[model samples]
Each structure stands twice: as structure tokens, then as C-alpha cells.
Target: MDRTPSFLQQHKQTFQRVGAVLLAILVWQVLAMAVGHQLLVPSPLSVLERLAGIWLEAGFWSTVWFTFRKIVAGFLLGLALGLGLGSLAGRFPLFEILFRPWAVMVKSVPVASFIVICLIWMSSARLSIFISFLMVLPIVYTNVLQSIRSVDRQMLEAVQIFRLPWAKRVLYLWLPQMKPYLISACSVGLGISWKAGIAAEIIGIPSGSIGQMFYDAKVYFNTTDLFTWTIIVVVVSVLFEKGFLALLKWLYGRLEKL
Candidate 1:
């Protein structure tokens, strides 16, 4: 019998989730009808219609792709830098001290302030990339560094005593030890990257971006368009997180099997 849990058993909850979503949408539709103003709150059907319209347009995919590329670029860059810096910080007190202030500032300062300040240094063209990077860096770095620092000392002593090969040390010692923190960091960082990237694009209004569409919708008071685009962002963000986390977990499973 293939008893392995191929994935987390969430299938049973699917019906519940669908019911909850339907209920929420019903509530929203009723509220919108009571308001009697599309501008105030668009009906669910109208928003779905708007979504269909946008989906049929040629530029829709292009807009989604552009924003996706920018956000992913920044997210990967931040994740790479964080992993590197976190390793250094974990190993050396001086390195950790040097990074503490920067990490703290990145986590503490409002994202809007960073977006504005970044405008002075770079054009709006790359605003999303930079903003997303800034948003994700501290989170990934902090989690990874803390994980490394808290690695089981006994595990390390055993590895040293056995004089295990570097490959085994990494595969056996590090991956298992750091998997939870790594997953946590990625989960949080990915969400922040999307939010910050979109916010930056909204403020900067770069051409051909999802954020620009939002701005145009707001300018014309197109509630349907706004709601449609907002729903797209949420769906895309959620899907990306789920896909990426699943892939990471799958890889971890393979490592464990080894």
C-alpha cells in the first residue's frame, strides 16, 4: 500500500473552503445590493464579469507577466542575499552585530517610507524590484540567521566526531535542521514581496504594470476593474505561495528519504 502522504491532506477541507467562500460572496453581494452603488462596493457578478473582460484582453497577460517578473526577481535576489548574509551572521558575532541595525531598520520602517526614499535613488521602472527586495530581505535573513544559531550543538558534535563528509553534513545536518525556518522565511517573504511590489508599482505607476491598471481604475472610479484586479493579485499571490511551498516541501521529502 502506498501509505506515504504525498502531500498534506487538505482535500477533505476543500468542501468547507468552497462553502466558506460562497457564503462570503453571498454576504458581499447582499451588502453591495443594499449599498446600491457599484462605486462603493461592486457586486460579485459584476466583478467576475470584469475579470472575464480583462482576461479576454491581449494586454492582461502581459501586465501580469511584467509584475510577476519584477516581484520574482526581487524576491529571489533578497532570498539569495539573505541566505548568504544569514550564514555569515550566524557564524560570526561581529557579522551579526554589523547586520543587526540594518535588519532592524528594514523590519521597523514603514514600507511607504522606503518606497519614497528609494525613489531618490532609482527610477520608477525598477521600483517594484527594489521595494520587494527591501520588503523580503530582513525577514528571510532574520529567520535563517536565528535558525543557524539555534542548530543543535549535540548534532554538530556528533557530526564532527564522526567526521562525516561535507555532503552528508549539509544534507543530514543542515537541511533537516533548517527546513522549518527556511519554509517560514519563504512563506512570509513571498507575501511581503507581493504586497510591497504592488504598492510600489501603484505609487510609481510604471507603464504596463498591474498597479498602473489599478491607478487608472481609481482615476475613472471603475469599481469593477479595481475589484477585478485586486482579486487577481490575491489569487496569484496565493497560488504562487502554495506552489512554491509544495515544491520546497517535496524537495525536503526527497532529502529525508535519502
Candidate 2:
């Protein structure tokens, strides 16, 4: 086997990605200078400086913590419901028929409309959690149900013929098959959850939340602050996705090994 350096082999793409980000930032900085109005477009350096300041503020961490908890709770709730409902629907035609309409309605209805209506029943503080849950549920349900349905009939038949134990079927068949669909659902779901959650907060303007700060930034035309907060959201969303996917991939590897 060739003994190449791990960082060189594994992180060449990482270096390329970092270069791309730097290029984008350079372009943004140039555009900001061309605009010549700080309110309209703050330079990249100004935004970075603002972000650094926010990182040091005690209130920033509190806001982040609150938002993180709400969004993550919503995501977990949606995932659980999706798994439970998807399994039922996949196993039984009746369940599929019963659940598909609701899922379709959730998918078809505009998220804004849901936010408006939900606000009436729930406090603004809880808006993000509910909206996140609603947005993520359909995607998860569809992916999982499809994964269940897409199991190769021939392989299933072979397993049945072989009279394999349920544990073996799960280990060799179901786990392998569900891995991709689960990862895909989660990857998509988590991103959307953060987006929807933040949007909900922005609309609701819950006090002391990042959304409130974002709204303040917009209201006051604080372009640098807006850019800084936007960067924070993007960073948090990306980190959450990467961390969650890493956990999912690790679990998958462990399951496969078993």
C-alpha cells in the first residue's frame, strides 16, 4: 500500500475550498468599495471585525444558545415523528394513504402562511421550534418512506428464503439500505431547520434572540452588523450540519462493522 501523508491526501479538497472562500471574500470587498456607501454595502474587513466583537459579547452566546436549543429540539422532534410515521407508512398501504395527504399538505402550504397561523396559537418565543419542526418533517418522512420502499425485493426474498434472524436482516439489509436515505434527509433537514427557525425568529422578533438583533440591524441600516450576523448564522448552520453528519456517518460505520 502507498503511504501518502494523510493531510495531503484527505484535506486537499479542504485547501481548495478555503481558497474559494477567500476569493469570494475578495470579490465582496471589491464590490463594497465600488458601492462607496457603507450603509448599502460594508467591506468584508468591517463585517469580520463586527463579527469578532459579537463573538466576545456575553449576550451573543446567550442568543446563540437559545436559538440552537429551539432549532435542535424542533429537528429532533421532526426526525422522531418522521421515522415513526414513515415506518408505518412503508409497512402498510393504509398508513401510507392516510399519512401522504397530510405530508403533502405540509409540503404544499407556504411556510410563511404556517408561520402566520402558528403565531396565533403559540408564543413568538416558540415560533422557531414549531416552524423548524413543520419544515423538516415532510422531507424526512419522504426520504425514509422511499428508502423503506426501495429495498431490493430480490434481496429481501433471499433473506426470507434463508430464514435469517431479524437481527441479521437489520444488520445486513435494513441498516445498509437506510443509511443513505437517513443521511440525505438529515443533511437537508438540518439546514432547512436553521433557516426556517431563524426566519421565524426574524418575523416574530423574539426579544434577546439573534433574529431580534438581525431585525434591529436591518431597521437601523447597520450593514456591517447585518453582514456579521448573517455570517454567524451561516457558520452556525454549517457547523451543525458538519457535526451532525459526522455523528451519523460514525454511527453508520459502527453499524456496518457490527
Candidate 3:
């Protein structure tokens, strides 16, 4: 029998990640000290101080919610459409051909180009949603379709031979096969969605958005505020990814049990 890992071994990866982040912060602090100019480089301490008090800033929560809701909405819309269309495409070659051109165009076009084009058609308030959706759609679609296509022929035949009900087939066969790919796609898609959505907000300068905060930080040349907001964005994005992936895994577990 294989030996189980010790507690330290089990948590080694987490400890390493924490150490890496601490080392990066130490380096940043050293760099700021060497620069000796607050405007040029605010120390990590100053950024943390700003972060501690940022919640009290006027419109802070509202601004965060404004960006958060739109970006999350876009991600959800993309997830739904990608799964629906990808499933159809996997089942029918004609559907694949039908969607191929649009997928190729979306994947090929630069995000900045899309932002410019979208600005011509829509207001800044909705820009982040569209960009986030566009960023996520192809990624999820490709992963889902590939997962479906990669299913084992022998396993599929066994299901057919057993005359398993549709629900059972999905629970026992499809879900297991698609789980890893879907998780991976969502992980990648979430990160891309945040990046694209934030970029859209910055360009469009949507009022009361995180992008607006960033733009203001840049315009005023407040390095501490800028660093503080950057840290907030990173923390929020990481938390969002972790929570979403955990939920997705939990959902999979519940479904598998059913």
C-alpha cells in the first residue's frame, strides 16, 4: 500500500506559495527604499495602509459592486452560451461549421479593436460586460467541445450496449469526462474576463467603476492609491476564482451523487 503524506507534506504547496508572495513583497519594499521617492514607488507599507482605509472612501463599495456585477454577469452569460453552443457543435458537424467563422473572428480580433468598435455602438456602462463575455466565450466553447470530442469510444459503446438511461449516462460517463476540461476552461476564462472587463472600463472610463478608480489614480499620479487599488484588484480576482472553482467542484460532486 502507498504511504499517505504527512501534514507538512500535504500543506507544502500552500506554504511555498505564501513564502513566494512574502519574498516578492520584500523585494518591492527594497526597491521602493532604493528609489527614495514616494511618487516613483510607494513602499508596500504605505500601500497596505491605504488598503486598510480604502473601504471608508466615498463610493468604494458601490464602485466595487458596479464592476463586480457587470463582469460576473458577462462571465455567466458566456458560460451559458458556450456550453449550449459547444454541446450542439459537438453533436452536429453542421453546427460546428456554422459557428466556426464567428469563433475564429472573435479569437483573432484584438481586444482593443473590439473596444473601439463597441464604443461606436454602445455606451461605456455596458462595455465591460460585452468584453468579458467575448473573452470567455471562445475559451469555454473550445474546451467544452474538445472535451466532448475526446470522449472514449469504448466507454461510449459500453454505455450504448448497457442501454443506460440518459441521466445515468450523463452522471456516470459525460460528467466525469467533462469535469476537468470545464474546470480548466472556467479557471482560464475567469482570469481573462477580469482582465478584458477591466481594460474595457479603463478605456471607456465608466463612472463609479474600478477602472475609473485606476484612471483617477493615474491622472493624479498617486502611487500609493494606485498600488492599493492594484492589490485590491489582485485580491478580489484571486478570491473570486477560488470561490467559483470551489463552488463548481461542489456542484459536480452533488450531481455525481445524484
Say which candidate scores most in TM-score. 1
Candidate 1 residue-wise lDDT, 173-238, digit = tens: 877877999999999999999999999999999999999999999999998898999999999989
Sort by TM-score, best first: what order? 1, 3, 2
What is the alpha-carbon lDDT for the whole of candidate 3?
0.93
Off by over 4 Å in 3: 1-12, 162-168
Q: Write the per-residue lDDT of candidate 3 for residues 1-258, one digit (tens) a residue.
A: 879998889999999999999999999999999999999999999998999999998999998899999999999899989988998898898999999999999999999999989999999999999999999999989988998999999999999999999989878998789899899999999999999999999999999999999999999999898888878877888899999999999999998777
Regarding lDDT, does 1 or 3 come out ahead? 3
Best by lDDT: 3
All candidates: TM-score: 0.93, 0.91, 0.92
Q: How close is candidate 2 to the true structure, as a TM-score?
A: 0.91
lDDT of 1: 0.91
- The runs of at least 3 residues in candidate 2 whose Cα sits more than 4 Å from the true structure, single-residue gaps closed, are 1-12, 162-168
Task: Please list the Cα RMSD from the true structure of every candidate, rounded to 1 decimal place.
Answer: 4.0, 2.8, 2.8
**What C-alpha lDDT values do all the predictions have?**
0.91, 0.91, 0.93
